[model samples]
Target: MTARDNRLHAFRPDLADARLEGEVSAERFVAGRPARVAAPVADVRRAPRPDAGLNTQLLCGDDVLVFDEAEGFAWLQAERDGYVGYVSAADLAPRAADPTHVVTAPRSFVYPGPDMKLPRVRALSLGSRVTVTGEAETRGTRYGLLPSGEAMVLQHLAPIGTVAEDFVSVAERLIDTPYLWGGSSAFGIDCSGLVQLSMHMAGRDVLRDSDMQAGALGTPLDPGPDHSALRRGDLVFWKGHVAIMTDAANMIHANGHTMTVAREGLREAIARIGYLYGGPTGFRRP
Candidate 1:
């Protein structure tokens, strides 16, 4: 395997040759069963405890393959990106039989009934999938029925296959969202999370980390001395960070430096990131 394939395979053991046998081997994991995130947001941890380091997160309706359960945690693999970690067993449920819609808005609320006056059940973030059981209109507002019997505003959802016209525009909508390590939700997100979420909304599948994204995703741009050659929608990569150019002169990214999704001058970002995290390794266009 090439270095890039090696990196992808390392995190996604299920993609490796089934003949390879080991503790992480997928072939020996026939007992694994499918599940779905039952909560609005579920934290996947490095270990099975609240204090354990967070490895990633799953939004409501995200699919997971449960391998084992111990105490109150389930050791599972996130179906979207093949991420493996432990999540609260209570945060998962049997996969919905017919998920037809996905959350398109940055965030949306689920209520106990069709009435807006009903108590809120929970908040779901963008990309959350849901099985619509029925539809109702209350006070002129349309609501979709969830598998759990709750109701959510239909305006916040789109058919499962809907895709945005521009990935950059989707990212731009997340400006000012707080930065969170290993976060992929609108509530908190990281550099690659911003890219991955935006790309996913645009009907593109992308890896979950900066280095993985740098190795995959798009065609490399011709080498340039600075940001002078970059254009709108170009992906710029540094040693451990990534950003999306909004225009020839400006770029948007979620960076620890700013601790939020922010837009800055591309030339100035190149200079600042170069001094701080070393210059960008390269650029690519999708």
Candidate 2:
């Protein structure tokens, strides 16, 4: 684990994933068990303690490989993006069959039955994978039935292979979402979380952090100081922040300044954030 990123690798001083036995040093290794996120949102923490710093988040139905379960936390690696962290043990469940659809709405409610008047079960965020075992209808509204005996509006779900023509449009739908440090859902989100969620809906899964995204994700562009080269869908980056260009003149991001996902004039944003985080570190077109 010397050169491998701990955020994406399973390792600690006393233990490591069995898959890394020959490539990394550890006192012992174990091939972890498979599981899926049971909570609507599970905070992935840097350490096992309840107050440990949050590194990322996993949505309901997200798959994980659990390496250890102790202290009421599961040390695991997310299957979709390789993010490794500790999630509360209560938020995990035995692995389910493969999902067939993704939640397309920013947030969609799960109902006890196909009827809209019934009490709600919970809400699933956009990009959450769901296994649609069957379909039901009530009063002209279509619903996708899940294995848990819950129903989600079919209008809010897209078949697994569905893709968006414009990923920026996906981000636009989340305008004014409250900014959260490591939130993973539409209820709240961060700079990189916004990018990853929007891109996932567009069928382009990306890394979890601004730095990781800046280093990967797209073709690098030499946008000059004024950023005259930027256009729609281009990603602009600061040291620890990232934003998607809505157009040449505007961009959207979840920033602490506004504490919400908001659009800003490109020039104003550059100047305001530059005073703190310095100027844009890179530009990318995906």
Candidate 3:
């Protein structure tokens, strides 16, 4: 049998998703159970341990297929991008949540009630999905209510099918966000995570990692030696890194160099990144 990417396939030595029964070897196979993320943000880890590496994050209302629940963790696959990993069981509920709206602001506050002065229930990250059961008016501020009885500022949400005019602007909206390895929200984000989140806001869904992105994202572009051919919304890639061009000469990225999402000169980036990771591997335009 051919080796498969477990991040996209659900299988393990002891058990596997029954859907892959004939294709992979495992001691047992069971169908994945439906679930939804109930937490504001869920860390999907490479292993079940809290200290294990985080492979990705899931926003509230994201649907998942849970294969196993053990030791306070649940092994599952994100339905959005098919990335598989372990999420804390506490962050998930057994029902598949249906979403009517998505958080459009960099972050949104879930309130105990419809009032802005009410104590905050939680801070939901951008891309967090919610079902707007109804609307409420509190002190002239409008709010969207959820089935669980929480409320979010109605202005911070957009209807489920709403699309952004520009994905690049969506990326720009997250400038100065903290850089985190596997984070996907406005609270913190990585390079590819930024790309994935911004693109999703524009109604385009891409794969999660840099290499996976480079392999399948967009058409190739020429950097013109001086790297002037790059334009806004174009993606430049290195061995394990990626960035978004904001203009012919400038680009914005969530980088370890600055520890925050910041803009940098393209020439400066090419030279700085060349020292440690070498020059740009390729460029693409979506």
Clashing pairs in model 3? none
lDDT of 2 by residue, 155-267 (tens): 99999889888889999999999999998799999999999989888888899999899888899997766778889999999999999999888999999999999999988
**Residue 232, candidate 3: how far off, in angstroms?**
1.2
Each candidate: RMSD: 3.2, 1.4, 1.6
Q: Model 3: runs farther than 4 Å from truth? A: 1-3
Q: TM-scores of the models, in the given order? A: 0.89, 0.96, 0.97
> Backbone clashes in each candidate structure, one number apiece?
0, 0, 0
Cα lDDT computed for each candidate against the true fold:
0.83, 0.91, 0.91
Candidate 1 C-alpha lDDT tens digits along 162-275: 999999999999999999988899889989999999999999978788887787778999646645777889998899889999987789999988899999987788788787
Candidate with maximal lDDT:
3
**What residue pairs are clashing in model 2?**
none
Alpha-carbon deviation at 255 in model 2, angstroms: 0.6
Worst 10 residues of 2 by lDDT: 1-10
lDDT for model 1 comes to 0.83
Query: How far in Å is the alpha carbon of 4 misplaced in model 2?
Result: 1.0
